[model samples]
Target: MTSIKTKKILSKAGYYIFVSLLAFAMCYPLIWMLCSSFKETNTIFATATSLIPDPFVLKNYPNGWKGFGGISFATFFKNSGFVTVLSTIGIVASSTVTAYGFARIRFPGSKIWFSCMLLSMMIPFQVLMVPQYMMFNLFGWTGTYLPLIVPSFFINGFGIFLTVQFIKGIPRDLDEAAKIDGCSTYTIFLRIIVPLIVPAMVTNGIFAFIGKWDDFMSALLYLNKPQQYTLALALKLFCDPSSTSDWGAMFAMAILSLIPVFLIFAFFQKYLVEGISASGLKG
Candidate 1:
């Protein structure tokens, strides 16, 4: 019994040590970026291997915030916030309704439509980008936020799938009970389903928020004016292969850019984990 107990202790210690090293490996890039942000741009590459900056300059934050073309990083942040918030709302609202229909309602061709949605998930966004760009250009939406914000109103396949799985876990007896009380389908969804599916909704909302916040491609393709640039686009302004690049400023801003996402994840981490686990197990 003593030998067995010692073996278990050794196993647990080995597991924790392995996990700690793995975590550090994964986090090293971010840590390096943070340290590099305070170093001089020229020395950044020279001492790239080092985690600690020899002489940490405080100018990077101020200089980066100054931004390019007389536009501050604040504008970029505002634009990102606008797009992310609206896109998240659109995702949650549209996906929730669609998931409800797919999960709870029995209609002709419902299964077929759900299958099509699943199939849609298999198709990469790159395949549709050209056609979408052409269509948006024809609509004169290439330079506008419409192209970025409009498509989010439609069914988000992953979000719908996640919500549907979560909704499936909910007892159907609740729906029947609501119906017996003379509640309409819409009424039941609003009053009964929505409240119970909070975890799934929060999960989808967090995913949507992160996706929109980190979306560089869509923003780059749609927005042309520097004033209308998102934070991701603004980051590009710091890089110029043909000329001097403010590596320090870029890294500083990049670190600052991560704060919102980090804070969000830290706060909603419990819900995110619970939602994903519950959805996976239930649906």
Candidate 2:
């Protein structure tokens, strides 16, 4: 019995060690980027395998923040924050209402409409990009943030579907009780269904924030001015393969750009996992 227990303990230790090694392997690139950010640009490529910076310099942060075309990194941060916050709010608000309507209300062609919405998700965004660009261009919104922000208010197929599934898991008895108390459909949705689907809303908001924050293609296509650029676009400015590049500054800014996303996920990961799992199960 003692020998068997000893074997089990050894197996567990081996498993944990293997997992730790695997995790480190997966994380090595990020680790190397962080380490290289402190080293001088010339030394970055020379010490590719080294995780420790022999002569670390703090100039990368200041230099990167200085930015190209006289636009600072601060502008990019502010732009990203504005877009992300608004887009998140819009998605959660619109999707919750739409999801509530689909999940609870019985209207003509409701199932057909919902089916169509779900079907739209399978269609790749690239296929629609050209037509969308042309439409926005006709509206004279190509040079502004409207092209990026406005569409979010209309509909997000995934957000609506996620929320509808979660809302369906809610007990219908609550809606009945609210109605018997003379509550209108909107009131019942606000008072009963909205409160119950907080997890799904949060999940949608997190996804929206991440998507908007990391959005490069839309910004690239619509935004022509330097002041309108996002963090992703600003990072691209660090690279000019046609000429000299500031590798150190680029790495530093890249590391800094990841901080917000990392913190958000670290703090709200439980809600994300819980929301997705619960909604998926209900569906």
Candidate 3:
């Protein structure tokens, strides 16, 4: 028994060591990028083998911020922020309403419709990209933020699925009790159901925000006007085929881009995990 216990301890220690190494490997690139962003251009290449920056510098941030097409990085940040916030709000509101109906309300062909929604999640975005672009062009919505913000008002498959799972975990007794208290469905939904599902709503909103913030392909395909370019698109402005690449500034911008995502995740991480966990539990 003592030998078996020792073996189990060794196995657990080995498992933790493996996990720690894997974590370090995954995080190394990000760490390297951040360190390089603070180093001088020459030092970056010279110290390529070293992860630590000897002479730390912060000039890359200001240079990158002011360097992109003579436009300040603040403008790009504003554009990205506007689109991300609007998209997240629209997605959360629409998905919540749609998920509530699917989970609680009985309507004609609801099951089939719900199944169809699930199937839509399986379809790749590439398949719909061209058609969507054509449709946006027909509406003359290209080169504007409308193409990014408008579709979010419609139900998103992942958001709907997440919300539906959360709502399903809610006990029907709450609704019945609210009804007995002369509360209307709208009131119950707005006041009670929404509050109860705060975790899920927060999770979905965070997910939507991150997606809109990080989106590159959609922004690249639709946004033609330079002024309307998001931070993700603006990051590519540093690329020049003939000139030496501004690796330091590019890395700085890349690191800057991650700040908002990290903040959002940190703020909502608890609720996101809770929502996911609760959704999987039996009511």
Highest lDDT: give the candidate number.
Answer: 1
Candidate 1 residue pairs that clash? none
Candidate 2's residue-wise lDDT over 1-283, tens digit each?
Answer: 9999999999999999999999999999999999999999989998898888979799999999998889999999999998888888888898998998899989999999999999988989899999999999999999999888888897999999999999989889888998899999989988888888888998898889889999999999999999999999899988898998899999999999889888888888888997899899985
**Backbone clash tally (model 3):** 0
Candidate 2 lands at a TM-score of 0.96
lDDT of each: 0.94, 0.91, 0.91
Greater lDDT among 1 and 3 belongs to 1
Summing lDDT over every window of 10 consecutive residues in candidate 2, give the lowest-scoring window.
189-198
Give the runs in model 2 whose Cα sits over 4 Å from its true position. Answer: none
List TM-scores for all candidates, in order. Answer: 0.98, 0.96, 0.93
Candidate 3 structure quality by residue, lDDT tens digits, 48-140: 889888898999988998855567889899999999999999999999999999998999999999999999999999999999999999999
* Candidate 1, 65-149: lDDT as tens digits: 9998899999999999998899999999999999999999999999999999999889998998899999999999999899889
Error of 2 at 156 (Å): 1.0
Clashes of each: 0, 0, 0
Displacement of residue 77 (Cα, Å) in model 3 is 0.5
Global Cα lDDT for candidate 3 = 0.91
- Model 2 has a clash total of 0
lDDT at 192, model 3: 88
